[model samples]
Target: MTRCALQAGALYESTSITYTPECLDRLRKAFPGDFDDVDEAMRSFDPASAPAEMLSVLRSFTPARAALPGAAAYFHAKALEAIAALSMRPGPAAPKARREDRELVEQAEAVMSARLSERLTAESIAGELFVSRSRLCEAFRRVRGSGVAETLRKERMDAACRLLSAGGAHIADVARAVGYARSSSFDEAFRREFGCFPAQWRQDAV
Candidate 1:
């Protein structure tokens, strides 16, 4: 099987193993830093050998695996490398920034940060940066791989998340603070962006 297929299979299998509270805690803590190590540890784990609670938890966490027919073993190795590297520390050398695009991206990021409460349209940002809307869109897409509206939405959501995590802000207050005039609109947007309602997000964050 290809590396991605193998990794996906491994993830699927590991997710099926019931983890103890201690094991789950360790896995969660280590996952951010060393997913490969966690995967390695889970390789030999058996759900039948685990406590009932752990097995119960595994039932919810485990994903169903699909067969990767016609996948090559070489591709599996490459996928493993990709997955492992995704969780590893950066190597000694950082990649050089693209100076022109970097400058524009920085400017766009700054504008988004500064005007979190403003109804920032792509045209307005393009005008402020002295570029045509299409050029601005291209620059943003080249640098961020997303359009201006998506970036703005991300920034607004980020701001909202921060405010929600602070623990005293009402949903409506946060909605207004992040530029949505109507609370219902903000709630809908928040749900679409984050897959959860603002109140649920706040509770979960807390």
Candidate 2:
């Protein structure tokens, strides 16, 4: 029973629990090869690891057993149920980036800061570093927990607010300086992001 349990657990870990040499040998004595492989595949299988064909085979196994009606059917059903449950449960999450990836992210952020007024895109940044956009986005999200566009918008807004509070530059100038092409666009973006117009924000800051 302990051996069965351990073998069952091992089978559960796999996407498809195909017959081991021992299990195959035992099944062969009672059943033909037609169902032996299918039986092994259905029991203690990990749905993820099992091919679609294996799942279909497993599903058919119970009905096939009903045709003959044996101990194999009982064991097969129990193992199949266990494997199905395992498959339904979520898999382990991916591990996060290491410290080296974090450092690369910081370097990317510095690049962003230096080009605040320039139109920056994730692809452009990733291209500059010879990395894929997905990898860059993943690293940035790991460290900052925000997308590249959102981070850039926040930085631009922060700069705009600082300029507004300083009260030396005209709103239009501040907007242009912070990468906004027009005052109206800047005002709209500011309101959308900061919940107030740039002038209103300036007044509140005062």
Candidate 3:
């Protein structure tokens, strides 16, 4: 796998993975319909960005197998998943800036999803990408049509809804899980986002 070339201060990390021919053959067999798409992905390879979750799986893998019984199979399955993920089609191509900006937006969203319980800030996320907060904000606005802060809240709210729908946890716990420091703040945001409080939403979901 080759990373796509991206703009300065792009959020997605750049890395490449290589698979043996056997691995590639397995991928073709696993996802026959997406075989052509995988070829296209390789042909149009970019060095700037890759699918983040898939790339992470690729990176996390160690060539050395675990001692456990199913370890070999597990690693093989993961390799297959990684390749299939790369094979999946991305959205329509945009201008350079737009494409890079969209990547930043996705990286920020992924951070929000992963760090929902932490008091993370856009500045912190931008710092990780070596980009200034203002630049990151500009990119987010251009790509997602929302400021980073709003996007963060939207992510947290979406997470909150999923937790609520799952039907467990106290309201306060749910609030914290989605990055709100206080239940009152969570309730207010949830009302604004969904036109009802979290408790009510849970009730309605049931």
Candidate 4:
């Protein structure tokens, strides 16, 4: 989402950002030492440490209600969303997502695959993809025949099962590996998903 490239359409945004040298010079003057190593700052921005409150605040600047009638509101709303996202990276631009395919389901799947370990929610994932939470879920349901939460849970549980089968990692470790915050929560989900606890499944597999 931070790529900040302005793509025009209903949800109009491309994940790309550009900074001109003139802009850089102005910023350097404003922030001085901070801009000296802008690229380094951007590269070092940790995803885990993304300022949740700050990002939320920046994103909130976008107009909540699409006040404009018809297509104009789409542009107004999403253009601001892109602008807000551009401010996220402390410096370097996020690599732009390819323009060829804007398929939400495919993009969502790719995102899910890449960040299995990190804590994720459908809303946060949607925010990262520059789409509304409802839009994201609808896209999943339409194309994948499942909800986003269901897909994510399945992926996490599948990873957890593989870890359990391997037999070296403890259940707590497995839980964290699959994005659960605690073993208890993981146990509940594991049982729900498989109709058996993780340990029992592993033992039975053995």
Candidate 5:
């Protein structure tokens, strides 16, 4: 998992548990094609996305407990299970993710990051990159473990949250800036993502 401060004074907290090389090999074998080079994804994955059962099991373990006799094996197994779940790709396995796919994902990410204020779709992104939508989506899922549309929705929501937290833009303007043309639609989407309306979230954020 990763975290970024939204601004100069912003605070973001996160935690990560790196697997042993042995565990990584186990995960790679378990996930197969989609698990290659997962260490290099530019996009940050939230740990909250991990399976609840795995998280619960892993959470009950600690460094001291992991070192205890007999417990080490159990903890390592649970940790491996959690990472395997976290590494599962969204789409069906096609082939071992290619380095070219990494390049394509990077290009697509750069385009999406630069164009969040504009309406974007798989077709438009593929057109901009001169690649097929299937290739783009497949590459994106393999690299980021998420679909393009889902990732784009998250990008827009994240941008909106940053704007909301900084305290100047009106709700409707925030909506438009994040590519939603209709305030009502933006409001609905915002609530679906964050469980609150834009105005209410802004009030809490600032």
Candidate 6:
């Protein structure tokens, strides 16, 4: 996921679970579709349909810097369970339909990721994507579980946090860098988003 796809200061770590050729083949059968690249594969997935167990695992996961003795086997078992659950989804899979839905959301996310430092509105983004404002909002809500504005705000706040952590930049500079028009406006929004003023957050970070 891009920085825009997660909450500010959130870090996602993927565990390395070794699988044999046979296991890899099985997973290939389960997911089935030739993806040109990792991004293509991810773009084809619908996060909304990810099973509750898988979601829970992802949400509660912590980085394992040192591998556990049975970790591979345990992860393999969970993978099989998740694949089984995903496979049981009713009706013949209309992959094309799902891909279309995923693509709409992915495209919007790509645009937002690329332009987070600019003043973006639903209308501006919709116009760039050649979709209506309502349609763009719907796609974001369906896929990202939030509206475009909310995503943009989070991204901006996260970026500000990173900048604050680094230390040295003036608040006004940080405000403009994240697309706010004025430091006072940035201070208000930052307080609302982060529960502290920028200066206080910077002090804590230092």
Where is model 4 poorest over a 10-residue stretch in terms of lDDT? 31-40
List the candidates' TM-scores in order.
Answer: 0.52, 0.51, 0.51, 0.51, 0.55, 0.51
The whole-model C-alpha lDDT of candidate 6 against the native structure comes to 0.62
RMSD to the hidden true structure, all candidates:
15.4, 20.0, 16.6, 18.1, 16.1, 18.0
| Leading candidate by TM-score | 5
lDDT of 3 by residue, 37-110 (tens): 34435656664576786867767665455666788778777776676566553634433457788888788778
Give candidate 5 misplaced runs (Cα > 4 Å): 1-96
Tell me the tens digit of each residue's lDDT in model 4 across 1-206.
23445656647632223556676555434321123334333445554555564355334444443353564655544443443333334433333433322388788878878888777767678899999876776566456555566678778888887888889888899987877666777787688678999999999987
Which portions of model 3 miss their true places by more than 4 Å?
A: 1-96
Model 2 lDDT per residue over 1-206, tens place? 02234554454432334446675444333321112223323344454464454456555544446567575766576564543333233223434767967887887788777877655566677798889777776676566655455566677888888889899789999977776666776787688677999998899899
Clashes of 2: 3
Q: What are the lDDT scores of the predictions, listed in order?
A: 0.60, 0.61, 0.67, 0.62, 0.69, 0.62
Per-residue CA lDDT of model 6 for 34-74, tens digit only, reads: 11012222334465566586565454334361266677666
For model 3, give the 10-residue run with minimal summed lDDT: 28-37
Question: What TM-score would you give candidate 4 relative to the actual structure?
Answer: 0.51
Clashing pairs in 5: none
TM-score of 1: 0.52
**lDDT (C-alpha) at residue 143 in model 3:** 83
Residue-pair clashes, model 3? 9
Give the better candidate number (2 or 4) by lDDT.
Answer: 4
